[model samples]
Target chain A: MPAPIEFYFDFSSPYGYLAAQEVEGVGRRQGREVVWKPFLLGAVFKTTGSAPLLDIPMKGDYAKRDMDRSARRIGVPFQLPTPFPFSAVAPARAFYWLADQNTMAAKDLAMALFHAAFGQGHDISAPDAVAKTAAMHGHDPAAVRAAHDDPAVKQRLKDEVQAAQDKGVFGSPFLLVDGEPFWGHDRLGDAEAWAKTGGW
Target chain B: MPAPIEFYFDFSSPYGYLAAQEVEGVGRRQGREVVWKPFLLGAVFKTTGSAPLLDIPMKGDYAKRDMDRSARRIGVPFQLPTPFPFSAVAPARAFYWLADQNTMAAKDLAMALFHAAFGQGHDISAPDAVAKTAAMHGHDPAAVRAAHDDPAVKQRLKDEVQAAQDKGVFGSPFLLVDGEPFWGHDRLGDAEAWAKTGGW
Candidate 1:
């Protein structure tokens, strides 16, 4: 077994959803435990001076093609639920809401929300859509909505986003094991190998 | 048959050399011409607020791995050049010197410089080394060196670097076939295809 692996995810990114689907299985194969850390990507972009993929003319197409190649190579289901970038504010807040109730429930909610937003083309930013998604995963819809609006819950999500920035995280599906940050889904194999060797 | 493709290159980049060796072959098969454009990468970085691969921790390693993979896939002979990130001043100036004489000489000089830097691990920044490499490729060493230091040649090289910035180039090995800029060696194939189809 290896040190704990922390996965930081943003519901708005298709790559984050893809990473969520296979991270657990890969970690299990390498005898590593995993935890989910859902954070706001907007905060990350503001702090890092990062540009959206669509803004970088050639990079977006290349990245999509590369991701498809990677998904096929890894034998995973890959789909872009929406053609446009979905606002992730509500979805991100819902994650923190789940965390306050139970850790395991929070993990499940994060995966469910990712599937809804990036796997099924839903507008995850809508409070109603987010509440509905949480309900599908067995949480009370009203309770989840109320929890999402809590000032403390929203601030906790903000804090996690700030933490990701401080840790030098610049992109989605950032995985950290034993304090070493691995950015991008392509680094997943390296992350697994590092985890296996128990390298910090 | 297709229109000539502009091959933007910088001697300091290993990938540019790798692409140079094969781009002509690709052009030959499609009955197209390759226009060699040697510009300073440092100038591009300054205009775009970008850094070299070595400056981006995880990305640098990814570049090395990708280059190795690309070499095997393309059957190109590749070795990590010594004294990497060489000063591009001399080489860029040397290339402009050759270009002033004739286009063919510019093409040959570009290949020779790439091979000298990445293939033979030579210090391309040194005047003597560049002269020797040019001589080995049948160009007159003394003439090439003299042309390199000419005030007009120096100014021309500086102007081309500035022009590349004006054209929105921010990275090395940028291919602008038919007025469209393809920013990486990986996009060489696309540039070639675009040339073949007369697509900008």
Candidate 2:
């Protein structure tokens, strides 16, 4: 069997949330596994000189509508958070912490967090909210809270961001199917096709 | 009948070249007329704090491949110009000049210019190159050259850019179907659906 596809995202990104709903299904249909990897988009942005989608002037309003339209088209529930572009550090750290122990559980936690932020329109930048989501997902809230602050977990998130940049991932919802980089939810279709056909 | 979809683009953009090849067909399939309007993207960039896509650090390389991949997917011919991001002033000026006299001939001229730049990979940044492409399309090269020197034509392009920015166009291949803005060549699908359903 071929290697699993790498799905990279930042928890703060709505497009990433949208992609989270689809990448796994696309990979499964192709008989390949999708490894979810969350990274710091801010770190990539520092090098790329790009700001958050909502921070850009005129494009912000259009992006807002596009995200909504795209979610509706894709049949996923979505609602923008009151304070968007929130910090993904809590979720990123938690994901890596859990991933080291149970990768599947970590993925469930990531999905729950995304649903909380985009589906429920909750503020997830705080560790407490992340812990709450973990509890809802059948994980211990206290353990998650502690893990969110663990130095090793914190360092794991940092190292992953550096590794992602080294791997040429400059945007959220980035994916590497057989090592070909596909950025954004828009390119998810391209990545799926590449995985199916093994590139053009 | 609904109003024609306004398609805005800049001459130097590869994505715009891709859109130019597909947008008219998409509009026609939906029984909607497409009005091609060439604008100076640099003007929009100034206000939105965006530089050229190729000027961004890591995204430049990715964008180059993305353009090629997108063109291939759309079955449109594409070749990066020899010193890309060349001055599109000549073509933009000529387009406005001819648009005043004959809209259909102006569109043909735009398509020919796009073909010269991306399809044939020619350096179409100069008045002479623009004239050459115009002459190839059965337009008078001498007359186009004179049109290039016309102040009214130059101002017409500038005014159009200003008007496009006012309509929240931050990038090339921007489209408005029934006054809803959709940006990028990636959005042609959404625009088609919007036109067909009169928007969801």
Highest DockQ among the candidates is held by which one? 2
Model 2, runs deviating above 4 Å: none
lDDT of 1 by residue, B2-101 (tens): 5577777777887887788788876886687877777888765654455676556545664675566556556766777767788878877888787777
lDDT of 1: 0.73
lDDT, residue A133, model 2 = 91
lDDT of 2 by residue, B49-71 (tens): 89889879999988988999888
TM per candidate, chain B: 0.90, 0.97
> What fraction of correct interface contacts does each candidate retain?
0.00, 0.65
Top TM-score: which candidate number? 2
Please tell me which predicted candidate would have the highest lDDT against the true structure.
2
Two-chain DockQ for each candidate model: 0.09, 0.72
- Find the 10 residues in a row with the least total lDDT in model 1 chain A: A54-63
lDDT of 2 by residue, A1-200 (tens): 98999999999999999999999889888999999999989878888889888878888888999999999989988998878778999999989988989989999999999999999899999999999999988889999999988888888989999999999999989999999899989888889999999887
- Worst 10-residue lDDT window for candidate 2 chain A reads A51-60
Candidate 1: TM-score?
A: 0.63
TM-score of each: 0.63, 0.97
